[model samples]
Structures are given as C-alpha cells and as structure tokens.
Target chain A: MPFAPALHSEWLKIRTLPSLAAGPAAVVLVTAAFTALAGLDESAGADSDPLFASLFGVVLGQIAAVTFGAQAVSAEFRGGALRLSLSAVPHRGRWFAAKALAVGASALAAGLLAGCASLAVGWAVPGSRAGGPNWGEGLRGVVGCGVYMALMALFAAGLTALLRSGVMTLSILVPFLLVVSFVIGGVSGTAADYLPDKAGQVVLHSTSDGALGPWTGLAVTAVWAAAALAAGAWSVRRRDA
Target chain B: MTSIDVRDLTKEYGGRRAVDRLTFSVRPGRVTGFLGPNGAGKSTTMRLVLGLDRPTSGTATIGGRPCAALDEPLREVGALLDTGAAHGSRTARDHLRVLAATHRIPGRRVDEVLEEAGLAAVSRNRVRTYSLGMRQRLGIAAALLGDPRVVLLDEPSNGLDPEGIVWIRELLRRLAREGRTVLVSSHLMNETASFADHLVVLGRGRLLADTPVREFVHARAEPRVRVRTPDGAALRDLLARHGYESVAEEGEGAGDRWTVRHARVDDIGRLASGAGVTVLELAAEERTLEQAYLDLTAAEAEFTAMSPSRAQEA
Candidate 1:
C-alpha cells in the first residue's frame, strides 16, 4: 500500500487512543494555564527579560510534547502491536515514515496552538502591554516557541524508537530536561548549551550569551533529531519483531 | 489457489536454534495441521512465513513471492500470530478499520467479518473489555477482512469454547473447500484431527512427521479390534482357541464388549461366522490422534517436566 493510507491509518490510531490524543491536548492546557499564572507574578526586576519570564511555562509544556512523541513510537514495542503493524504494512521503512509523520504533524499543530495561547496570556499581563506588539523579537519568540516544541517532540519520538520503550525514554528525559540542564549546568559550564533541549530553547530567549544563535541552535537540534531518527529506523529494520 | 513454501528455513536466537532447517509446503484445498509441543517452534516458523522474523537461512514464500515483496500483502495472505496485539484502548471496529485502511479494505468487509466471527455485538467496545476468546475472534475477523487466499493461524483454537472449536473447524474446512490454503497450529491433537486433512508434526524444532492424517495415525498408533456380541464368553473362548487373546472393557457393558489386541476386524468377523456366534458389532478401533501424536513425539521430544528430585538436583 501507498504511504497515504498508512499515514491515514496511523492518524486513526492516534485519534482512537485517548492517551495518545491526550498528549497534545495537555500541551495547550498546561502551557497556557501556567503562562497565565506567571503573568500575575509581580516580583520582577526592571532589567529582567519579561518575555522569557512570561514564557517560562514552556519548560513544562515541552514535556507534553516529549510524551506525545515517545508514546507514539513506544506503543509499537508494547504487546504485539509491532507484529500486527508490520503484518499489515510489510515494508518497515514505510511504516516508520508514516509514524514519524503522524507524530511530527500532531506535535506541530499542538505546539502552534499552545504557543499562541501562552503568548496571548503573557501579553495580557499589565506590564507586558507597556510596549505592545513590538513585532520584532517578540514575534520571533512566539513562532520559535511553536517550532522549538515541535522539534522537541520529534526528538523524543526518534529517541523512543531507538530505545524501543516509552518508560525508559521518559525516565531519562523528564529528569534531563527538567533538572539536569538547569541544576547541574548551573554549577558546571557551557556544556548545557549544546544539549538538545537547551540548544533548541535558545530561540525562546530574546538575548542570549552563547556561541550558537537561535536558528543555529534549532539547526543543531534538527541534526540531533535526524541522527536519532536514522538510528531508530535502522534498529526497526534490523531487529526481529 | 495459493501455496506456502518454506525451504530449508532456520532461525537462531542468541546461540540456541529456535527453528532448525525446517522445510514444508502447504497446498490449497486442504487444512494442513501444524502440530507440535510447547516451544516446538510452530509460532516461530509461522512468523518466518509472514516475514515478521527474518530466517537465519533459506526463504519462505507465498505464491512464488516473499511476503515482503508483495505490494498489497493483506490481499495475498492473512495471518493471526497474536490475538491480543491490538491496543487496549481501541474498539474492535476501530482496530479493524485502521488495518483495513492501510489496504483500502472497505468498512462493509469489516462488519461482515465481525458478524462472521460473532463479534458484531461488541464491535464498538474497547478491546480491553473483551474476553480472551473474544479477542481471538476479533483477530480472526481482521484476518478475513482482505479476502486473503492463504491463511496462517497459530493456535487459532486457543481459549475457545467447545462450540467455538467446532466453529473454527468448520471454518477452516470451508476455507479450504473454497481452494484457499489453510494452515492451523494447535496442541489439541484431537480437536485438530477432527478437521485437519493433512498433518505436519514437529518436535524439538525438527519435522517428525509430515503426511496425511489417516496415514499418520495408522503408521504411529496401534490397531485394535472391538467386538460386541450377545455371547461374549463364546467369542472369548473361540478367540483363545485360535491363540488370540482378548479382554473385555472396564465398564458396565464390559460383559457384552470384548477388545482384541493386534487383531483385524475381517479375521474376527470370519472367525465369529465360522463359530456361529451372533455378532452385533465388530469394527476396527483405530487409535485416536492424540495417542498417535504421543507415540510419534515420544522419540523426538526433548523437553519434559522435571520431577521434584530432578528439580532439586538442578
């Protein structure tokens, strides 16, 4: 069968599965809710970057992206799901491609919606309206929020496929993204800047001190996602169902 | 009609061989029973045929093409390797729809199979709520959605009730009758014997017997004669005079029925007629398929449950 039908079938699977569909919806709710709460916080220095402060909820929202991507790929490793899928579409490459497309497209749509909702709420705070709709760095950050989250999701998906598990991916990632990059990197040095999550999030910062710029950081993240996806694809073809 | 051809196929996981140099061909218009003990590699061989697992050597093909090479595999072969492979969250109809969408199979075919497998009532319910037997029926429904020419079922009768067993037996026979190749695996020798036209017995990852069901039972099991007459004592005395030892069955009607070992029905009939004894029934009592299977596997089987002492020693 062609890739169109395979993609359609995968889309149906995602829609029919409540947990699978919840991942993306959670991104919008959590990101928008947290960003709105942060908008009410009054303890802010005059020199502080307000956009970064308001958009900080992305740290939590991106986890939802990771979950969506990881669960989508890891689901195949559970029970006999892989066997049934492969039996339906014998070509391993086509199956993986359809899965990657489904995950990427879903994350993209969710990320864009969450980014817009969070940005609107962030702008709603009394101080954020002081210089409203700059349409320069502010617009870029909003768009970048969507792109960065989507990339994070795809990255998680590719890694999940390589590991052939959702729990293992989440266990390693939920900590690395939430804690290690912030705490350990705080005491350590510039190494965190090169990590996928940290590097990808560079676009969220209006002004950053780093050798890599916003687009370059995303490009680096894209490379990582590509490499991981290649490894995952190779693993799927090489391993026995 | 289609055929499944496995040629010198072998599979090794780690260092242990799972399916060793197995070669067999299943032809259309018949139900070929794939019989084996637990871990005898029946599932593994079927996986190889479906291209779910790569064979360490050789190839298994359907209609002269590897399963992987088929552009539309569902149209060629329908296989049931794992019944519960579906996600627990999806409904029976949803599960079939997703699979069918890949091959563009219509929704009507899905309903038809749901009805055929007796799963139409619960088609909208989640798979997690279905019983093991119901899950098996859904799996069968998925297999039939594409109108396949060859069907490979692994332990298709597992977790089914007696009525379901009879249903599957008739289904396989009917599928074979329609000239579709049907290969079913089961440890229940008696149940398989009721439907299987041919037998493929495996033991310790090797082919032990691959022949017609009738020929296999006759070759492996003992042939006995059951004689029922009004004068059982006269029949026994007459048989003993001819150096034929006989014993009555252990039941309420034992006095009326005598079981003669290593005897032919024709000989017993002739002897009974010469003796002028009234005979009601005299027929060859062929050993059941289960007994024949045990007899054949006794020499080929390698694994058996360990006794308490053996376990302690190990």
Candidate 2:
C-alpha cells in the first residue's frame, strides 16, 4: 500500500484518542512548567550553564515523550487490536512503519514546542541567573530539545513494539530514566555519557564536558532509537498478529 | 468473486496442533457455515485463511493469491474475527475511519456502513460506551466497510440480541444472493442451519464433514423410528424375534411407545403389519442440526456438558 493513506490512518489513530493525545501535550506542558518554576529559584551556582537552567525541566518532559511512544504501540496489544490492524493492512511491516512514523512526528512536534516554551520561560525569569549562552548556542538548545524528545518517543515506541506491552515497556523505562540514568550521570563516567536518555539530553545543556558534543550526543540517542525500531519492525513482521 | 483455498493448512502452538493439516475450499456465491464445538479450531482455520497466523506447513489463499500479496486486501476479503477489536477511547466513527483509510475508501462509505450497522445514531459516541451487541454490530460494519467480494465472520451472533440475530441471518443470505462468498463460523449448529447453504464442520482440528446443511443434520441424526401400538408387548416380541433392539420411551404414554434405531420406517411398518398388530403411530424421528453437531463432535469435545434435554429435565 502507498504511504499516503496509511500515514493518514496512523495520524487519525493518534488524533482520535484523548489518552494518546496527552502524550505529546504533556511533553510541552511538563517541560515549560518545570523550566518556569526553576527560573524562580533564588540560588544559582556561578559555574552552571544558563541554558541548562532554562531547560532543566526537559528531564521530566521526556517522561511524556517515552510514555506517548510506548502507549502508541501498546494500545495495539489490547482488545484484540493487533488482529484488527493486521486485517486492515495485512502486511505487518507496512503497518508498523506507519505507526512508527506517526509516533516520531508527534514526539518531534511536542519536543519542539516544549523546548521553545521552556526556553522562553527561562529567558523571561527575574531571579539571579548565570551568564546566558550566545544566540547560536541558545538557538541550538531549543531546536535540539524538540528533536531529542521526538527521538526518545520513537525509542520508546520501538521497544514497546518489540515487547508488545505498554506496561512492560514503562516498567523497564520510567524508573530507569528517573533513577538509574541520573545516578550513573552523577558518577560522570563515560558509560553514562552514552546512555539513550542522557545522550539525548546533552542538547539541553549549553556546555558539556564529555567528548560527545550536543549534536554527537543526540546522534548516539538516534542510533539507539534506530536499533529499537529495527528490532520492532522485525518482531512485527515475524510474529503472528 | 473471491474464493478461498486452504491446502493442508496446519497451525501448532508450542507442541499441540490447533489446526491439523485442515484442507477446505470456500467457493463464491454461497454462505459456508464453519461449524465446530468450542476449541475445535474453527477460529484457528479462519485466522489462518486471513493470514493472521502463519500456517505450520500449508497455505491458505484468497482469489488464488496469498492474502499478504493482495493490494488493498480489505477490498478482496473483509473479515470480523474478534468482536471487541476496537479501542475503547476512540469513537465508533474513528475506528471505522482508520480501517477505511487502509483501502483508500471514501468518507461516504463510512457513513453508509454506520447506517448499515445501525450505528449512525451513536457514531460520535466512544466505543467504551457501546454494549456488546452494539460492539458486534460495529465489527460487522467494519467488515462490510470495504464492500469486498469475500466476507468472513467468526461468531457474528456472539453478543447479538434476537432481533440482531435475525437481521444477520437475513443479511448473510442476501450477501450470498449477490454472488459474494460468505463464511460464518458458529458453535451453535441451529444458528448456522438457518442461512448456511454449505457446511464445513471441524472436530479436533480435522475436517469431519463438508456437505449441505440439510443432509448433515437429518442424515447424522441416529435414524430412529418411534413406534406406537395398542399391543406394545406384541410389537416388542416381534422386534426381539427380528433381532432389532428397542428402547422403551417413558412419558405420558408409558409402555405404548418404543424407539427402534438403525431401521427404516417402511421395514418397521412391514414388521408391525405382518404380526397383525395395529400401529397407531410409526413416526421416524428426524435429527436436528444441533443433535447432528453434538454426535459428530462428541468424542472430540474437550469439556462435555449434559445434553440439552437432560439439562432441561434437571
């Protein structure tokens, strides 16, 4: 089947459900809400990156990105949904591609919106702030934040498809992002630099210490997303609906 | 018209076979009833045909081509396998709209099917609010959305009311009249008997019978003759002398009725007359489709229950 109609169908599925729609909406709201709140904090370390302070809420916003991704795929595993979807398309690969595309698009939009809004809130705050990054660096952080969210969402979508369970995906992902990745990040080890969540969040920081720069960090996260998607596609093609 | 051909189709999960080299063909212009006791692999066969599950060793194809190869598959074969397939959060229209988009179907057809399935009034309502009967109707609507040449329904009457059942019975007959291939699966033999012109029955993942509905029912029914005579004792003696077994039926008229199995009505009548006994009634008891289905699948039944009559008596 041509991509146009399949894409349209996938888009409709995304727009139709309130819970699914909440995924992207939450990404923007959470990021902006947290970033705005952080700007009001009176204490600021002299060496802290100003852009990082503005976008501090992105860490939590990504929870929405991953949730949206997992839910998009997980909904198919419920209510005999896989049967209905496959019956309509028959070719599992094609159907999954459409689903992945839809998830990626939504996450990208949500990320961009969240990234921009968080920056605006941070830039406008009146509290004691560190020296703000120059224009080029500031612009990169906002756009990179959006792209990061999209990639993270796709990453979640891919893993959910492989597992075929949203609960399972969230169970492994949510706590790991909130606890394990940060703990490893605090250690400032090279291994933490390459983690999917941390690597993607590098764009939110104006200056970084590791060999991996903002763009390079996002690239590592993208590689992870690509691998998950490849596995997810294989699973959809080989398994019975 | 679309015809489905299953060539030695087999499906096994882990080690046990769910469908064992099952071969059957569903031709166009007729309603084929897929009959089986629950877990006799009726749904499995349908799933295999739809390419929902990969066959272990064989192939099932629609219109002489594999289902996966068909372009816009819904246009060739429309299927309703699981009644509760829709997502609860979406409205009924959204579900149909998504399926319709797969085939590049027009929005007009979506509205048409909403009316067709009697879901027009609640088109905007979320699927979670719909009753099981309504959900079944929505499934039926989704199947018909493509206006395909072949239609497959698995237990379409599952949650339907009496009116919905009658409506579906009429609908399937009409679809067949239009020269489309229609296959409907049901555990209820009597339900399928009402409209299915052809019957393909499975027992323990094997083809038990693929024949006309009328013959499968009455022919399989034990072929017993109910004899009633004023001199029942004399009739019993004659039956014993002829080496034919008789079971005395107890009821309102005890000792006046005896059922003779494996004997034609004419032979029983001849024996009664030769003995100079006046026969009051010599009616041959015809078997219903329900009974035929039970007798055919009794051995294969994984969990047997009391017969309908026995249950009623209890």
Candidate 3:
C-alpha cells in the first residue's frame, strides 16, 4: 500500500516482461558496439573529441532507453492491464510514481554499465588516431552517459503516458532524434540546442558550443523530462483507463 | 465482510451516458448477478465501482470508503474485468506475483491460487500461449491472489468451457459461503440463475429490475396454463361462459390441447369437472429463466433483429 511495495511490484513487472527487460541490456550492447566501431574508424581527425567519439554509440543506444521506458508504460494500456493495476493500487499517482521510479532506476543502471563498457572499449581500440581521453574527461563521459540515458528514458516514459500509446510516442520521437535533431543543428542556432535530446547529449561532449554548459544542458533536459512527467501524471489522473 | 454500495453513479462518454443515475448495493454472503443487454452499462458500472473510470457524479464505495481512498485496495477487494487483463509476455505465475507484490501477499499464496484455478500445470507458460479458457483461469487466479473480502467479475464465463463454467459456479458459491461479497456480471440468464440469489438488471444505462431471481422470473414473465380435454368444444364453451378464452396449441392433437393465459389451472379443472367435461392434462407451465430474461430485455436491447417473417418479406 505504501510506495515501497508498489515500487517493488512495478520492478517485478519489468523483470518479467521480456521486451521491458531487454531495454537495459540492449543499451549496453548497442552503445558499446557502436563506440568500439567508431574508435576503429581511420577517418577520424585529430580535432575530434575522443571522449565524444568513444561515447558516440549512445546516440543509437538511447533508442533502447526510450523503448524501455515506452514499453513499460504502454504495456499497461494493452489488454485492460491498467484497470487491473488501478484496481490493485487504486491511487493513480502512487502507481505512476512507482512505474516511473522503476523505469528510471533500471535505465540508469544500464546506462552506467554501457558507459563503462563504451569507455573501456574505446580506450583499448588499436591504431586509433584520436588520443585517449584524460581522467577527468573519462569520468565525465561515463557519468554523463548514465545520467543522460536515464533522463532520455524517463522523457520517453512521460511522453508515452501522455500519449497513452507506445507506437505514437515512438513515431514522434524516433524520427525527431534520427532526422529532425540533426536538421535543426545544421540550420537553427542556439534555440535548437535546447531540444531535449540535443541539450542532454551535450554532457557526452568534451566541449559544448551551446549557451548551456554540460551540467546546465543536462539540467535543461531534466526540466523537459519533469514537464513531460507532470503532463503524463495529469493525463493519468484525468483520463479513464 | 465488506459490501459494495453504489449511489447515484453516473458516467457519460462523449456526452453519451454510459451509466445513468443508478444505485444498488451488493450484500455479503450471496452472489448478486449484474445482468444487461449489450451496451447496458454493466461493465461501465463495474469500472466506475473500481474507480478505473471517473463518474460524472455520485459515488461507489466498498465497505464504507471509496475504492481510491483505501490505503490497501487489493487486501480489501479483488476484481476480474476481463480475460485479457494480463500481459501476454509474462508467465501466469509471474503475473500473479506482480499483483501479489502490491499488497505484500506471500509468494506461496500466488501458487495457491494458481493451483486453485487449475492452472498450476501450465502456470509457468507465457499468457500468450494460453487458450481463452486458460486466460480466463489466469484472470480468476489473479483475482484470488489477494484473498480479499469483496470480489467482482465481468462476464467471467465468456470463454469458459462447460467444465470451467461449472467450476466458476462452484467457486462463486464458495466465495459467498465464505461471507464474501461476490458480484458477477453476465448476459447469460440461465447461468446467473444457477448461482446468483439476487439480480440487478440494467438496460440502456438505467436500472431495470433489482430483486430476487425467483421474483424476477415470476414477476416479469407471464404465466400460462396448459389444458388438455377429450371434449375441446365443451371445455371452450364452458370457459367462454366464465369470461375466459383459450388458444389451441399446435402438437400431435392440436384441437384437444389449449393454452390459457390469466387463468389458473385449478379454476379450469373445476369448471371442466362441474360441466362433465373430462380433463386429461391440466398444469401450470413455469417459464424458464431464459424466456423471462428475453421478455424483459427484448425492448431494452440496443440492436434487435427483425422478426423472421419481416426479414423474409424484405
């Protein structure tokens, strides 16, 4: 009845559902594989930020994070599962909080693991023109990778709640990340940097060109996630299951 | 024991009232059947009671508090809204465990319900692999996970085989015997008549009848008397003199048999005896629950089919 048991219940749901459970593991695999491949590229110039290059796989790996968050909430909408869930918990706010916490914690754990794996493989790549990142840069990238992925996952989760459909959430987000974000970066100036993904990915860079520094960029993304979650919670409370 | 009390509960979807201003109470120690024609607001009422959907006005409470206000709902009430309530990817055991964890129910209790619902043999299988009947059993298993005092089910017999139907009937009876408040919704009149002691009939989002099963059948369905006589003309003449009319029933001996409404079997028998008319068969034909339900819900149905003759003409 208290928040702890509800959180435990949500965690159990994630563990049992194969699609949701695959999220964290996929984040690690995708990010590490891409980061290693990027490190092996000979076209990389000396001017390239090795830290960002090592963590480049995160750009693709974040899809898994988004999916993980989306699937966790979307599954409830399918097959009348939300009614069953609400019948058991009754308090919509508590259930949503528990769900968000479970998703955020699992994504954070996976992101941290992926960050370490990506950094290790990137630094060990042979014949790499890009030099190794300094100790401070390495720590920053690893921490940033974990926090950034978790925030992205939560962001997707909040949007999924508001939309109440994973397919719709993915349709809007996947293209925005794959196509729209880069297009904005090429044309739009400082305003484009404030986009949720763009702002959050700044932490993965060794140096940021945007108005926000690394922490400030992450903070901006956090605000986006918070606002999305607030909308999601409001939708859950106001709408019928 | 906790009872479900719904008071003036109204819910409207897109300006269409799904549940009108309705009120009813389900007492403990008995099974109350929630019956209705399609789109009759039975499921909507259940959803409102469980707080899955917000009501436009009024309240539905379990025990003395609204379901949302209960700190530990699972420990107080359990409901099976549909067979598809569980995710297909999770195993039956895991699904129950997830729900069980909400109230800190013991792991052993999950297995206990699985065994009770006759799903233990395949409890480890994913729900996607289950048959409709199996999914139904799994839903029942989830409802029993918390061992709550109040249980609600909506069309629980939808995909059940005869054996499963029998199993559910026994289960509902047992739950009632344990002094739990059990409310099950279904359009199957005979099935509900078999187990439920009280009935709450709904039509077009409005309450139609709320009474005992026997009373509903007796009060709503017109009773008829069948009379067989050797001298049909004499019996008919005697009945006509007494301000009674009879219709001949089609059968092996059409003219010899007659069915009379609004006339008691004993009255006809007395008249036949006094007039020297031999009565071969004289008995009151009680209507089946199905017939009674059809008669009551016929006008209230949303989609009534054209009569066979009218369809043929068209």
Candidate 4:
C-alpha cells in the first residue's frame, strides 16, 4: 500500500512508451489474425478444439509481451536513466517491486483480452465445437492465459536484470522459446513438456489427455516465473544501479 | 536546518578508491558549488549522499538522517543528475506527472513546472523530440516539482546556450534566496563564479578546498596592473626597481606596453607615479575565475602523485 505512489509512477512510465501499446496491440492482432486463418481451413474441421486452435496466437503474441517487459527495465539502463530513478527513490528493492507490479499487471490484462477474443473468433466458425465451450471453462482459460502472459513478462524482466542488455535478453529468450524448445520437443517427448512454452500450453487443452493437467501446467509455468522474478529481485537489490 | 552532512565517506570501485575520507556539510540559504575535473569523484560523492551508491566506509546524512531513512525522499531532497533519464517516448508533461506521482504531488504542479521551465508549448510533445537544452530544463523542472528543502544538480549547464545559462544562474540564485540549499556541480569554474556563494573543490578523490566563493577567488587572486607608456623600457626598469615583477610584451605593438604584477592596486599606482613614467592608462586587472582555478589546482601535487601510489598498491 505504501508503494502505491511508486507503482503509479511506474504505470505512467510503462503506459507512455509507444512500445507498451504497440507490443500489446501485436498480441491482440496476431491472436485474431491467426485464429481467423485457422478458421478458414475446412479440412481442419469445425469440430476441432476451438480454444486450442484460437489460443495458438499466443505463440507470436508472447514475443511482443516479452520484448515490452524486458525493455521496461533495460531501456532505463541503456539510456543511463537508472541513476536518476535511483536518486529519486533510494530504496532499490521498493522500486523494483513497483516496476514488476506495474509491468506484470499490464501484460496480464492485455493477454486476457487477446486470449478471449481469439477463442471467441475461433469458436464462432461453422462446426467448431470440439468441446462444450462452457462459460466457466472459457473464463478459466482466459484467466490462465492472462496469468501465463504475466509470468512470461516476469521471466523476461528477470532475464533482463541478470544480463542488463536488451539484445542479450532477447537473444537468449527468443531462441529458447522459438527454436530450442521445439528442438527438444522433437528429440524427447516428456522433457519438452517442462519447457516454459510447452508447460504454458497446458492451459489450452480442454480434454484430460494432455501432457499436463490445466492447474498442473500453470504450476509448472509459475515455477519458471517465480524463479526468474526471485533472481531479478535479488540482483536488483544487490547490484549498483 | 536542512543540510547535507557527509562524514568520512569512502567509496571503492573494486580496487580503486573513487571517494576517500570525504567530509563536508552543505547548508541551506546558499548555493554550494561542487567543483572538480572529470573523474575527480564529484558525481560519486553526490551518488553516495543520495544513497544511490553504497559507501565503502562512513555515511552521508540529510537533516540528521540518512537519505535511505527518508519516508518521502522527493519532498526532502530533489536531485537532477541526468537529463535523458525519462523515457524518450513519453511526453514532457507525462514524465513530470510520473515523478510528481511519486510524491503525491498534484497534476497542476506538473503544469506549473512545465511553465516554469519554459516547456509549456511543448508539454504534449514526446521527449524524444526535445533538444538537449529542453531535456535539461525538464530535468530541472522535475527537481523543483516537490518544492524540496534541498536541490542537487550535477552539471546543470552542460548543454545550455548562453541565454539558457543566464536563466539557470538566475533561477539558482532565486532558489537559494528563498532559503533552500542548492548544490550544483560543474567542471568549469567560470560557470559558477558569479552564481555560487560557497564552494567545495575536489581533486582526485580528495577535498582540495572548502570555502566561500568570494574568499576562494580573492585568496587565489593575482591582481596585475597593465601599463602602456611611450617608453616601455623605462617603465619596465622603473617597475623592477620598485619591487614589482614585470613580464615583457613580445609583438609589433609590444614596445610601448608591459604588464606589472602586484597584489595591491595602491602599490602598483604608487610605483607607476613615483618613477616619472607617463601612465597612458592605468587599470588594476582582476583575475578571471578560470585563472584563479588554474592557480588553485596547479600547485595540487596530491592529485598528480596519486597514480604512482595507486600503481604501487596494485
């Protein structure tokens, strides 16, 4: 509660950057676009799982989300603004907490909107009822997707803190998510299930026969998010701004 | 009283001592200029005082409490260390609003600062569109947003035009007159010469001098008397005989002019009149702040000798 001012300041900072809006916009647009494209494939059938098909947009949307999160902190260091921020708020720990809360909350809200829209568009297509698409399940999926996006943002923040460079954070995270995770999935079935993206995808499965149950998959993604955030918090408090 | 007291503060960057045994007090109601050359540790000292950098030894306190202990730091001490600190994509008004939010300051204060900094016309423009001088003004506006008791600005005139420089000098004087402690750092002595009332001079992580600006300038003053006479040779000999040191001119117009050095204006006048040399024009030349600064730091062997000691320790 006492950090409300700091949080408010961080929110204002995050919202004003064009990248913040542009990045989230990409998430929503890509989610809708991908769902629309998937909907056109008649052979894919309308009876296929609509939530999973629509949720595929996150594959691209997460990239923009991660970029926004990483730059939230990295841009300050790059522009030599961290010194000014630290001078205004001497307590590094409190500043870090406020930044995390602001960035994470924004990413979550954007992710939820993108997820729900994508699912609705995909399910609206003719004969696309893979499951009941119950409102409760749909709500849970949307909320879980939002949580997943927030966790990924936190993960990016942590990586940026550890590396202290925008390019380096992206270089490592992008390849790990896009290429390495896929490669591992192809080589070993079960091992790939624990990769962040793979674990996060568990929330999209409406049936019971997925690699991980919905809650179990969220817990797996949460582990990665927690570890990254913990590492970020420690480094932010210890290292010179 | 609102003041910054740095006591025996020390900062070590790995093996190098960036600031050592630094002790000084900056009091309110005056502009205290922190003067030092590049890498002389002026910024490091400020960072330590603001609690941005952890000191290796000792402590710095604001109003008898450490800067870290302040519940609302912006209200207590406002600092403008970097001009490009705000996100470039944000509008000038938004940037100030964010900083103001940290102190629960009203949105109207943001507009007030925008007007004060002469940024009202461009408040809606993104910071990336601002020139370096505009950015510097924005930074100052942010520092003043809280109406703090103490204001710290590092190299505030680094990128200002002549008019902007004059504006900053007047603004600082007005702030100090209002009973706020204003600490400004600059490598150029001439920049702070007329504006600063007190000075804390540093060289190579050591305090070289801490005194009133006028006294510092006066004590190091080498007032000279420039004399132009029809018979320059006669005037030189006359001044030499009167215990005044004269340096000969070396050009086409050099034959009729000579510079006689003396600390006292009266002595130079008496010597010129007593020697029967027609004084074409007699004026006591006051040393510029740059000249005085050179004289003050020229004799400082501690900084020059630091490299060898550091090499030995390594």
Best by lDDT, which number?
Answer: 3
Interface alpha-carbon RMSD, every candidate: 0.9, 1.0, 0.8, 1.9
Error of 3 at A113 (Å): 0.6
> What digit string (tens of lDDT, one per residue) describes model 4 on residues B1-314?
79999999999998788898999999999999999878889989988888877899999999999987788888889888878787788899988887887778999988998899899999999999988999999999988998889999999998888888999999999999999999999987788997999999987788988999888887887888776677777877777777878886653552466677754667766776877767676667877777777787886754465768654743
Candidate 4 residues lying further than 4 Å off, grouped into runs, are A41-50, A126-136, A186-189, A208-211, B250-255, B301-314
Q: Residue-wise lDDT of candidate 3 within A1-241, one digit each (tens)?
A: 5899899999999999998889999999999998888778877666776678888899899998998988899999898999998888889999999999999999999999999999888878884444677789889888889999989899999999999999999999899988999788654356998999899888888887668788998999999988988899999988998
What local lDDT score does residue A108 receive in model 4, on the 0 to 100 scale? 91
Q: After superposition, how far is residue B263 of candidate 2 from its true place, in Å?
A: 3.9
- The residue pairs that clash in candidate 3, if any, are none
Local lDDT at A120 for model 1: 82
Model 2 Cα lDDT, one tens digit per residue, A1-241? 7877887888888989899988899999999998887778776566667788888889899999999999999999987888888888887888899999999999999988897888888888876285666678778988899889989898989999899899999999999999999887875547888999888777878778876889999999999999999999998888888
Clashing pairs in 2: A111-A146, A112-A146
User: How badly does each model clash, as a count of residue pairs?
Assistant: 0, 2, 0, 2
Model 2 DockQ (Cα-based): 0.73
Give the C-alpha miss distance for residue A224 in model 4, angstroms: 1.4
Q: For model 2, how many clashes? A: 2
Name the DockQ score for candidate 3.
0.82
Question: In candidate 1, what are the lDDT values of residues A1-241, reduced to their tens digit?
Answer: 6899999988988888989989889988888888777667666555545566556678899999899999998878887889889988999999998988888888888877887787787887665535543557667777777788778888888889889998999999999988988775543237777788778777777776776788988888888888888888988888888
List candidate 1 stretches off by more than 4 Å: A44-47, A127-133, A187-189, B228-245, B251-257, B275-281, B302-314
Query: Is candidate 3 or 4 superior in DockQ?
Result: 3
Ten-residue stretch with the least lDDT total in model 1 chain B: B301-310
CA lDDT for candidate 4: 0.81
lDDT of 4 at B164: 88
Query: Which of the numbered candidates is closest to the native, going by highest DockQ?
Result: 3
